[model samples]
Target: MKLIKTEDAVGHVLCHDMTQIIKGVTKDAIFRKGHVVTEADIPVLLSIGKDHLYVWEKEEGMIHENDGAEILCSICKGDHIERGNVKEGKIDLFAECDGLFKVNIELLNKINYLGEMMIATRNGNFPVKRGDKLAGTRIIPLIIEEEKMENAKAIVGDEKILEVKPFIHKKVGIVTTGNEVFYGRIEDQFTPVILNKLKEYSTELVEHVILNDDHEKITEAIVNLINKGADFVICTGGMSVDPDDKTPLAIKNTGAEIITYGAPVLPGAMFLLSYFNGDIPVVGLPGCVMYSKRTIFDLMLPRLMAGERITYEEISKLGHGGLCLSCDICTFPNCGFGKGM
Candidate 1:
């Protein structure tokens, strides 16, 4: 691009977006990049204090900001993702469907390390609704070396830098364990909480079983739910170390591989995650989930619904940013709870 006086740029192409700010009203692009500067736009440019402007200049071995941003988009774009038209050298990405959003942090950092280029994304491994902004790609300069953009693509290779794993329909089963609830001595509150949570997903209440702290009976109930086409099973209560607490043992008896018997998160330290027959999830929930506004269950539920396997290493990392502030007005998922390092 070439820098020239705004008055003489009438026929030239704008190399970048011109931002027009209105105090407390609006601030947005008035003239987008690639716009052909006409006679009528000179006064508007001058009003914004633009005495000089950069005009597009075709050159070999160099790419404009919009083109560079497009390459960055190619590097990061993945399944179920959408990209907005480039503006001011930036391209914004969004989710095309409600699903699990993931970011390859390593790849993102590597690309950003390349000077004059950037990719900013929302923290990943969280559920996002359709049309949620996923990420943005931009170039710092009006133009960049073609070699630099090529290097960025090479870093990503074939793998996407961001992905939206679509959520699938699930048949959820609930097993409420505790002698008080099983014997009807106390109201069964856990099932109501579970049902409310399931309302956010495409799930059906396939089964609901109440059982005493007897590990054998709990195990039978869980296996029976899965055998009857339940893709996900959750056992509430009996997760702590009191001898009578037997939900963990019951989950073990079901032959599901336990991901973690305890997590580093608050309001859910005694959480248990497991998978039966290599794919079906069988979770053991602590009592906190029945009342807490947000817990580890909230963090892991979307991933499980998207069919992503949980690992012990991943659960251990929850120690960072795992404590919930428990505000009077809870804005979960949007808050820092369970957003680990």
Candidate 2:
């Protein structure tokens, strides 16, 4: 990495295309930040009595946090933001009326960047008062390879440097295994329950299969699903110690590595998780999950849809909040007992 002073440049900034080669070194072979650059290494520039060398370091981005308290002020619909109303990102506003209001992140950014701004309300344009939370911004850290710093600088232009993490979408497959359901001895109510829970996320139920609790049959079914492109596969029923319970054996027979065969959660403590090629995930759920208000299935389904691979340690942590009170109100959406988002 090289840093030429502004005075040393004949005209504009002495920027180089750091995208390709840095000091005749390729990206794969370049030294990272915190690497020591000795003076003896600079044979050309050191010959001119230049003792100092430029080094690359990681840069961090700015983030602002907002308090939850906010107040609406009374003002006309066209009024602008009151000057000096916001100090240190806190604001005090007048109440136009009593109602639920939401301050989104976009409006907050505009207010912060452009200063005083106009807001739209139900009655009319009103001057925004203090103690109003405009928006919320999450802090993000950025890391740039030393060789790519120059390339970044040249293309930065008027854009702000922000680091965003890529979102990973998890694909899940469901396999319902039970002789009673397959032969119509009982209704196939389990699959519907699982599907209804999975519907809360962006997950696609890529494959669905029903197999008798035969080890070989279940094993073959699981292998076919994985081969058919299933990142996460769920097998319902046959998780207990009953002789007819062959789901665990079937999952093991597929040769997929098992992470945990039993979880510490209630109503679904017998849950199991396995993986193959460190990519595909497989789970075995117990019968209690079918009718339980909150089970291991409910707890883990969101994480799976959110692209989180469950670990045994994380599953173990659920024991504290695993018990469901099964209240009469049945406010599952607002309850934290295993249903908290």
Candidate 3:
């Protein structure tokens, strides 16, 4: 290889892969193939302080090692991820598995700033090997900071985190207790509505009981359902402050610890959540729950199926964003009202 002057090297692009420049100029002032350069060449190339340096090459799907998708997948678990076009430090992800997993949002930020990103799935806390299938990420776009990716790496070391909850076939018992619905006054629409929602998840109605607004009878029905091994018990109607409303008292009589007798949410503020000694979850649903699009039932049912333990503090925090207006379009799926679950 021959040496060339810095001026001669100005307009010439790399003809071949170049590495380890020897840094000298020949009297002929022309660089030949394989002629190396040194620190003196740094002044001419104008490349410095970048987290990444690369030779410009045109190739399809060549992503940076610090890409956001790769970083997110490394921390998140599951397979079947869809890739999206890279742009401005953000990537979309969708989970194919129906389970519970934690996301390290802080690590996502670092990949965003690193100029390129890749998405991968959590391979039990160690670095994921090449060609491992990642969870589908195309549906949910995740954004992160470019510099925070390194910090995300350090925190992800060898921790066997629970990525998703195993699917549990839930057996639910529905108790429709209301004077209006029990008699020939009105049709029992609440039962059908609750059944339709439960059908969306993996569940079966183990028992369905229609009782009047009598606390003793309602309590007996609940106890009977528990004895039948019902995982969840839902009591519909009679959740108001009216004298005839006795669902709350009935649930309390079953020796269940009432988590919250009322929630901050609208259209379902009269909702109640309680847990019996066997850890069976019992929900006291209000009348509006039947007709309202957004209610406490809508918020809690998903978490219940996901096997999350409902706490009073978490239910209390729902007040701020839980109010769902009956919009004409009914955009419940996109809305974040109960997404905290």
Tens-digit lDDT string for candidate 2 (1-341): 35654233222211221122445655442322222334333453344343443433323431121111121122111122222243222334333322122233243344234322223322111112233332222111122233332332243333322111122355667889889988889987888888887665446767899878788988888888777877888899889999989999999988888889887677787888888777677889888888886677766665554445667776666676667777877765346665211
* Per-prediction TM-score to the true structure, in the order listed: 0.88, 0.52, 0.65
Q: Give the local distance difference test score of model 3.
A: 0.63
lDDT of 3 by residue, 218-250 (tens): 999999998998989999988899998899999
RMSD of each: 3.9, 21.5, 11.7
lDDT of each: 0.91, 0.54, 0.63
Scanning candidate 3 in windows of ten residues, the lowest lDDT window is 123-132
Q: Pick the candidate with the highest TM-score.
A: 1
After superposing candidate 1 on the true structure, give the runs of residues whose Cα lies further than 4 Å from its correct spot: 1-58
Compose the digit string of candidate 1's lDDT tens values, residues 1-341. Answer: 79999999987888778999889987998998777789999999999889999998867998777788889999899999999998667999999999999999999999999989999999898989999999988898877899999998888999999999999899999999999988889999888988898899899989898888899999999999999999999999899999999999999999999989999999899999999999999999999999898988998899999999989998999999999999999988788887774
Candidate no. 3 TM-score: 0.65
Task: Please state the error at residue 165 of candidate 2 in Å.
Answer: 8.0
**Best-first order by lDDT:** 1, 3, 2
Q: Given candidate 1, what's the lDDT at residue 37?
A: 88
